[model samples]
Target: MREKAQESVKAVLPVMVIVLILSFLIAPLSPDIMVEFMTGAVLVIIGMAFFSLGAEVSMTPMGERVGGNLVKTKKLWFIIGTGFVLGMMITISEPDLQVLARQVPSVPNMVLILSVALGVGLFLAIALIRILVGFALAPLLILFYLLIFLLAMLAPADFLAVAFDSGGVTTGPMTVPFIMALGVGISAIRNDRHAEDDSFGLVALCSIGPILAVLILSLVYQTEGSFSPEIGRNIATSVEVGQLFFEATPDYMKEIAVSLLPITVFFGLFQMFSLKLEKKTLSKILIGLVYTYIGLVLFLTGANVGFIPAGNALGTVLAALPYSWILIPLGMLIGYFIVKAEPAVYVLMKQVEELTDGAISGKAMQISLSIGVAVSVGLSMIRVLTGISVLWFLIPGYVIALGLTFLVPKIFTAIAFDSGGVASGPMTATFLLPLAQGACIAMGGDVVRDAFGVVAMVAMTPLITIQILGVLYVRRETQSADRSTGVEYQVDISELFAEYEDDEIIEF
Candidate 1:
C-alpha cells in the first residue's frame, strides 16, 4: 500500500508541478480555484494509489478466473456468447464512455452508449476467437482500420473526431485491467510459442469496435448540436472548496457504484456457477472491490470537479494571448507528463513488464508513451489553431502505425496497439479534452472538428513510438548477440594450477 502511494505520487507530481508553473507564470488562476485544484490533486493521488493496488488484488483475479473457466468449457459458442455479453456489460459501465457520451450531443446518450457497447461486445467476441484459434493480430488490425477509414469518408464530417475518439476512451481504466487480465487467462489455455503475444491485442481489437460502430451510426444520424464545455462554478472561500468536493463526492460515489456493479454482479454469478473458489480468495477479491470503488469515486470526483475547470481555464487564458501559438509547445509539455497520471497506463505498463519478464521495462514504456503523447498533443494544438480535419492527421498516422506492424516483433505491435487505448484514459477526457475545447473556444474554431480528436491523437501516436522503441531494442539485442557470436571462448587452467604449490596437492 505504501509503495503504491509513492508510485502514484511520482506519477502525478510532475503534472502538478507543470500546472503550478502555468498557474504562476503563464495562466494566472484565482486563489480559490487554485485551492480547489490542489485539493483535487491530493485526492487524485490518493485515489490512484488505492485503485492500482485494488486492481491487482481484485479486478485482475476475477477476470482471469472467469476467462480461464469460460475457455475450459471447450464450447466455442459458449465462450463467444459469454465474451460478448461481458464486453457489453463492462463497456456500458465504463465511466470514461459515459463522460464521452455526455460530451457528444449529436446522438442521444443511450443511443451512443449502446452503439459503443455493441461494438466492444462484437469485437471482444472476435478477440476471444482469435486467441483460441491463434490468428495473427496484425492482419485483423490492418483490415479493421482500413474498414474504419473507409467508413470515415461516408460518415458526417463533424462526427469524425468523435468517432475516432470513441476508440480511445472505451478501453479506459475500468475496462483495461479486466480485459488485459482476461486476455492472459484465455491465452493461458494455449501452449504455443504465440500464447504470450496473443495475450495482448484484446484491448487493441476492442478499441477498434467503438470507432467502427460510431462511424456507422453517424451515417444514420445528422450531427445537430454544437459542443459545449462544462463551465466551472465560482468559488469564494475555503469552505466552498470543501463544499465543492463534498457535493461532487456523492454524484461520483453513485457513478462509480453504477460503474462497478455490473462487473461485481457478473463475478458473483460466475463464482457461484463456474469458479466456486474457496472463501479466502473470494474474501480478498471482495476487499479489493471495496478499494476499487473508493478509488474510482475519488478519482472521478477530483478529475471532473477540479481538473477540468483548471485545464479549461488555463487553456482559455493561454489561447487568448497574442502569441497563442505557444499553446503547441505547452500542450506538448503537458501531454508528455499527463499520460503518466492515467490509472490504466500504470496497469498496462506493469502488465507488459510482467508478461515480458522485464524484457520491456516499465521505465522504457513510460518514456515511449510520454514521447508519443507529447507529439500527439503538439499535433492536436495545431488542429485547434487551424481548424483542420482530423482525417488529415489520422489517415497518415494510422498508415504509418499499421505499416510498422510488419517491421516490429509481434509482441511489440500488440503492446503498442494496446498502449494506444490505455494512454487515453480518464485524464485525457477530463483535462486534455477540456483544454482543447477551451482553446478551440478562444480561437473561434469548431470544437467538434478541432478539439474532439485530442484523445484519438493521443491514442494514435503511441502506436508508432512504442514500435520504434521495439525496433531499437531489437537492434541493440541483435548487435550484442552478433558480437557474442564473433568472439572465441578460451580458458587456461594451467595458469591457476601453476600458482598452486605441491603442498596443496595431497590428493595425488
Candidate 2:
C-alpha cells in the first residue's frame, strides 16, 4: 500500500508542479479559476490512483483468468467473439469516449459513443487473429494504413481530425488496463516465446478501428441533425469544498459508475461459467473495486470543479494578452509534464522495460512522448491560426508514420502507435480541451473546428517520434556489428596465451 501511494505521488507530482507554475508565473488567473483547477487536478490524481488500484483488485485478475480460460479452447470463433464482446463492453465504459462525444457537433452522443465502441470491439478481434497467426505486425499496419490514407483523400476534410482523435480518446484510463491485461492473458496461453512480442499491438490496432468507424460517422454527421452542447453549468453557490463535493461528487460518481457497469455485467457473465477464481482473489478484487469507485468520484469532482474552468480561463487570458506566443511555449512546457501524469503510461513504460530488460527504457518512451506532445501543441496552435482542414496535416503525417512501420523494428512500430493513443488521456480532455477552447474564444474562431484538434495532433506525433527512435536503434546496431566482430578477432586467445604458455615460462 505504501509503495502504491508513493507511485501515485510520483505520477501526480509532475502535474501539480506544472499547475502551480502556470497559475503563478504565467497568466495569473482569478481566484475562482485557481480554485477550480486545483480541485480538478486533485480529482485527476485520486481518479488515477484509485482506478489503478481497482484494476489490480478486479479488472486484471478477471480479464487474465477469463482470457486464459477462453484461449485453452480450440474453437477459433470463440476467441474472436469473446475478445470482440469484451472490447466493445470495455470501450462503452470508457469516460473518454463520452468526453469526446460531447465535443462532436453532429449526431446524438449515444450514437457517436456506441459507434466508437463498436469499432474498437471489431478491431480488437482482428488484433487477436494477428497475434494468433504469428503475423508480421509491419506489413498489416502498412496495408491497413494505405487503405486509411485512401479513405482520407476521398473523405471530407473535416472528418480527418475527428477520425484520428476517436482512436486516441478510446484508449483512456478506463479502457487501457483491462484491455492490455486481457491481451496479455490471452497471448500467454499460446505457449510461444513470441507471445510477449504479440502481447502488444492490441492498443495500436484498436486505435485504428475508431478512426475508420468515425470516418463513417463523419459522413453521417455531415447529413444528420446537428447536436449542440450547452456547456455544463455550475450554480453560483458559495464556493466551499464541502458544498461542491456534496453536489458535483454524486453527479460525476453516478456518471462514472453508470459507464463502469457494463464491464461488471460482462464480468458477471464470465463468473456464471465457473471462472475458477480463488476466494482470496475475488475478495481482493472486490476491495479494489471499492477503491476505484471512491477514487474516480473524487477525481471527477475535483477536475470539473477546479481544472476545467481554470484551464479555460487561463487560455482566455493568455490569448487575450499581447504576448499570446506564450501559448505555444507554455503548452510545450505543460505537455512535457502532462504525459507523465497519466498513470497508465507508467504501466506501459514499466512493462516494456521489464519485458526487454531495459533494452527499451521508460526514459526513452517518456522523452518521446513529451517531445511529441510539445510539437503537436505547436502545430495545433497553428491550426487555430489558419483554418486548414485537419487532413492537410493528419493525412500526410499518418502516411509518413505508417511508412516508417515497414522500416523500423516491429516492436518499436507497435509500441509507438499504442503510446500515441495512451498519451492522449483524461488530462487532454479536461485540461487541454479547455485550454484550446479558451484560446479559440479569444481568437474569434470556431471553437468546434479549430480548438478541438489539439488532442488529435497530440495523439498523432508519438507514432512518428517513437518509430524514428526505432530507426536510430536499428542504424546504431548495424554500425556496431562490424566493429564488434573486429574486436573479437583482435582479442583472439592465441595472442593472449603468448605471455603465459610453456615457451613464455622460460621467456618471462
Candidate 3:
C-alpha cells in the first residue's frame, strides 16, 4: 500500500509542479482555485495509489480468469457474446467517456454512451476472434481505419473531433487493466509463436470502435450544438473550498460505484459459474474492489472538480495573451510530463516489461510516450491557435502509424497502438481537453472542431514513436547478433525479426 502510494505520488507530482509553476508565475489562479487544485492533487495521488493496487489485485486477475475460462470452452459464439457483453459493461462504466458524453450537447448522453459502448463491445468480439484464429492485426487495423475515414468524410464538421476523442477516452484507467488482462488471459491459452504479440492489440482495436461508432452516429443524427465548457466558480473562503469538495464527493462516489458495479457483478457471476477459486483469493479480490472504488471516487472528484477548472482557467488566461503562440511550447512542456500522470500508463508499462522480459524497458516506453504526447499537444495547440481542420493532421498521422506496422515487429505495432489509447487517459480528458477547450474559446475558434481532438492527437502520436522505437530496437539487435556470430547476416526482415522474437521470449 505504501509503495503504491509512493508510485502514485511520483506519477502525479510532476504535473502538479508544472501547474503550480504556471499558476504562480505565468497565469495566476484565484486563491480558492489554488486551494482546490492543491486539495485535489492530494486526493488524486491517494486515489491513484489505491486504484493501482486494487486493479492489480482485483481487475487483472478477474479479467484473466474470465478470459482464460471463456477460451477453454472453445465455443466461438460463447466467446463472442461474452466478449461483447463484457465490453459494453466495462465501457459504460468508464468515467472518462461519461465526462465526454456530458460535454457534447448535440447528442443525448444515453444515446452517445450506448453507441460508444456498442462500438467497444463489437470490436472486443473481433479482437478475441483475431487472437483465437491468429489473424494478423495490421491488415484489420488498416481496413477499419480506412472505413473510419470514409465515415469521417460524411460526419458533421462539429462531430469530427469528438468522434476521434471518443476512441482515446474509452480506453481510460477503468477499461485498460481489464481489457489488457483479458488479452493476456486469452493469449495465455495459446502456445503459438505470436501469442505474446497477439496479447496486445485488444485495447488498440477496442479504441477504434468508439471512433467509428461516434462518426457513424454523427452522420445519422446531425444536430447543431456548441461545446459546453465547465464553468469555473468563484470561492472566497477556505470553508467554501472544503464545502466544494464535500459536495462533489458523494456524486463521484455514486458514479464510481456505478462505474465499478458491472465489472464487480460480472466477476461475481464468473466466480459462481466458472472460476470457483479458493476463499482466500476471493477475499483478496473483494478487498481490492473496495480499494478500487475508494480510489476512483477520490480520483474522479479531484480531477473533475479541482484539476479541470484550473486547467481551463489557465488555458484561457494563457491563450488570451499577446503572444499566445507560447501556448504551443508551453502545452508541449506540460504534455511531456502529463502523460506520466495517467493511471493506466503504469499498468501498460508494467505488463509490457513483464511480457517482454525487460527486452523493452518501461523507461524506454515512458520516454517514447512522453515525446509522442508532447508533440501531439504542440500540434493541438497550433490547431487551437490557427483553427486547422483535424483531418489535415489525423489522416496523415494515422497513415504514418499504420504504414509503420509493416516495418516494425508485430508486438511493437500492438504495443504502440495500445499506448496511443492508454496515453490519453483521465489526465488528458480532465486536464488537457479542458485546456484546449479553454484556449479555443479565448481564441475565438470553434471549440468542437479546434479544441476537442486533443485527446485524439495524444492517442495518435505514440503509434508512430513507439514503432520507431521498435525499428531502432530491431536494428540494434540485428547488429548485436552479427557481432556475436562474427558474420554479416543477410535475410528477409520478417525472418530476422521472428528469430529475435523467439530468442527474446526464450531468454525469459
Ten contiguous residues minimizing lDDT sum, candidate 2:
223-232
Model 1 Cα displacement at 63 (Å)?
A: 1.1
**lDDT for each candidate structure:** 0.90, 0.75, 0.90
TM values, all candidates? 0.95, 0.90, 0.94
| Ten contiguous residues with the weakest lDDT in model 1 | 487-496
Better of 2 and 3 by lDDT: 3
- Per residue, candidate 2 scores C-alpha lDDT tens digits across 292-384 of 677667766776666677768777778888878778877777777777777667667866786678988889898988888888887777676
lDDT of 2: 0.75
Report the error of model 2 at residue 240, Å: 3.5
C-alpha RMSD by candidate, in order: 4.2, 3.2, 7.1
Model 3 stretches with alpha carbons more than 4 Å out: 487-508
Error of 2 at 444 (Å): 1.0
Candidate 2 clashes: the total is 9
The window of 10 residues in a row where model 3 has the poorest summed lDDT is 486-495
- TM-score order, best first, reads 1, 3, 2
Q: CA lDDT of 240 in candidate 2? A: 63
TM-score of 1: 0.95
